[model samples]
Target: MIDVVVIGGGPAGMSAALVAGRGKKQVILIDEEKPRNAVTHETHAFLTRDGTKPEVFREKGRRDLLKYPTISIKNSKVLSIEKKAEDTFEITTESGDIINAKNIVLATGVTETLPNVKGIENYYGSSIFSCPFCDGWEMKDRPLILIAESVQALHVLKLLKNWTDNLIVTTNGNKIFDTDQKKMLEINNIRLIEERIIELKGIDGELQSIFFESGEKINRSGGFCTTVLDNRLPFIAQLGIKVNEAGFVIADVMGHTNIKGIYAAGEITGPSQLIVSASQGHMAGAGIIADSCEEAFQSIQK
Candidate 1:
């Protein structure tokens, strides 16, 4: 059996496999190569790597891991994971390969559902985005639109103010905000639109304008959205893993889940930056090393 199997090839899984491989343990990092960040043009907030393209960052990360002889990366999707016994798991891949591992690290991240607006996919990660901190600077001081349908969007509007005062927020015909929130937007000079969006006009992934059902057209160079997150995992249901109310896995500081020999890290635990996810993977790898060493020591004592 492999010493460790990491079920995501993102920064967290790769980092965990790297550390474990450096500890002289055999590791397999499996990934489907379909990453959420592939939609974005650039990534931000990682020192020395800020503004780097997502695919470039991933390629560089793979290069670093290639130096370790004990580490292997499998470019395939994991179809299912079955706990065969204590400290043993059988992972079935889409390619019909079954990999057995003594330890498992789940770095599977969450997926975001952009607001249900036509042509939104074209502008996402380009002229429109979800995270402000990631793309706010590039869109600073431009006429921006916020397509949000929830009350929580009020907070996002406040964050956008730091980048531009020329802001317009629309609820897509959903009046989900309280009266106080409406008053707050009015006081801040943020125009609020409560009509349904008819269409988003853009060219070459660049957002040019938004057409509302009320026959109103607003020109916006770039903007942001408050997207819904989906973090559900098939393994969680099969293995009965512990998760918080928000669908995030409940793991310790070292990334140990409630189940023995199973660990979790990265965005599945919570929304985290790239560096933070990598750091969590490192800790989880260290935890695996400690556990393996202790088990070996106990066997030697016997």
Candidate 2:
């Protein structure tokens, strides 16, 4: 059986496999290539990789990971997982192959629900984005709009203020905030619009204006929107793992889940920076190795 099986080939999964492989453990990295940020043109805030295209960074990461002979990557999706024994996990792939590993690392990320505004998908990755730290620099010094549909909208709008001065918040007809929230935003010169957005007018994936259902139009260069996020896979529920209210896997500091022999990292655990997610993967991998070693040593003593 393989020592470790990492699902999802993003930065977190790759980082975990590398660490496990370096520890002399046989590791398998499984990925489907359906990345949450696949639509994004550039990735930012990652030290030494800032402003680099997401694809470029991933390609380079794959090449570097190939240096470890003990690590292998499979271009396949995990359809389901079953616990074959106390210490072995049987992961079934979409291609019908079954992989047995002593431990499993779930790095499956979150999926974003884009607004139903017409023509929004065309500019989703370019002119419209989610993370402010990732795309704020590219949108600096421009007329920007914050489209919020949840309580998190207020936080996102506050963060966007750091990059652009001319900013407006579109609640999209949802009143999820309280009076204090409205007062704070008004004090900051951020206009709050509760009108429902009907459409996004843009050209060549560059957003130009937001059209409201009330026949009102606001011209803006670009904007960020809040989204309700869901896990890409329901494997957490299938494995009987506990997830936080935010729908993220509940993991300890070492990435250990409530289930035995199973751990998780990356966006599956929570929303974190690229570097932070990678670091968590490294820690989880090392923790798994240590636990396995301890088990073997105890058995020998017995």
Candidate 3:
């Protein structure tokens, strides 16, 4: 059995495999390649890799992992996981191959559900983004709109204020904010539109204007929105790994889950930045190495 099988190819998975390989542990990195940010044109806030294309960053990361002889990467989808023995897991892939590993790094990131706005997908990852900190700099000082369906909209609105003053907030038919919040926004010169969005008109993936069901329209160059982050793997709960109320996998600082042989990292633990995910993966890898070494040493004592 391999020392570790990382079940996601994002920054966290790659980082964990890197650490394990450096520690001379056999590691396998499996990636489905269906990243949540696949539509994003550029990735930001990752130091030394800021403004890099999402695919380009991944390509570069895979190349770095290839340098380690003990680390192997498999471009395939994981279908199921079964516990074969203590501290061992049998991972079955869509390719029909079965891999056994002493440790697991569950790094499958979250899937996003944007506000129920028409044609949002065309503008998403282009003009309409989820994180202001990631794309706000590019759209700073421009007329922008925030389409949110959750209370998290309030937090995003506050953050976007730093980038632009000409902003509009719409709940897309959901009354996520109350009268007090509406007055607060109006006091700050921010417009709040609580109508349902009919359509978002854009050109070349660039959002231009949003049309409401009430015939109200506003033109915006670019902006951010709030999205629901969900775990794609429901079967993870079957593994006896604990999850928090926010639907995030519960893991300690070292990425150790309730299950002794398994670890959780990246967006699975929670929505995380690229740098943070990578750091978590490094920690999980180190934890596995430390635990495995102790296990072997105790076996020798027996």
Evaluated against the true structure, the overall lDDT of model 2 is 0.87
| Window of ten residues with lowest summed lDDT in model 2 | 111-120
- Output the number of the TM-score-best candidate: 3
Q: Which stretches of candidate 1 lie over 4 Å from their true place?
A: none
Selected candidate, larger TM-score, 2 vs 3 = 3
Candidate structures ordered by TM-score, highest first:
3, 1, 2
Residue 103 accuracy (lDDT) in model 2: 92
Model 3: per-residue Cα lDDT over 1-302, one tens digit each: 88899999999999989988898999999999988789999999999999999999999999999999999999999988888766689999988889998889999999888888878999999998988878889889999999989989999999999999999998999988888988899898999898999999989999899999899889998878999999968558778788999999999988999988899889999997889999999998898888878989999999
Query: Which pairs clash (backbone N, Cα, C closer than 3 Å) in model 2?
Result: none
In candidate 1, list every pair of residues with a backbone clash.
Answer: none
Q: Hey, what RMSD does candidate 3 come out at?
A: 1.1
Give TM per candidate. Answer: 0.97, 0.96, 0.97
| Per-residue lDDT over 152-188 for candidate 2, one digit per residue giving the tens place of the 0 to 100 score | 8878988998999999899888887799998998999
> Where is model 3 more than 4 Å wrong at Cα?
none
- Please, what are the lDDT tens digits per residue for candidate 1 over residues 1-302? 99999999888898899988999999999998877688988889888899999999999999999998999999998989899966699999998889999999999888888887988999998899877887889999999999997876987899999999999999999997889888989999999999999999989999999999999999999899988776767887798889998889999988899989899888889887888889999988988999999999999999
Model 2 spans > 4 angstroms off: none
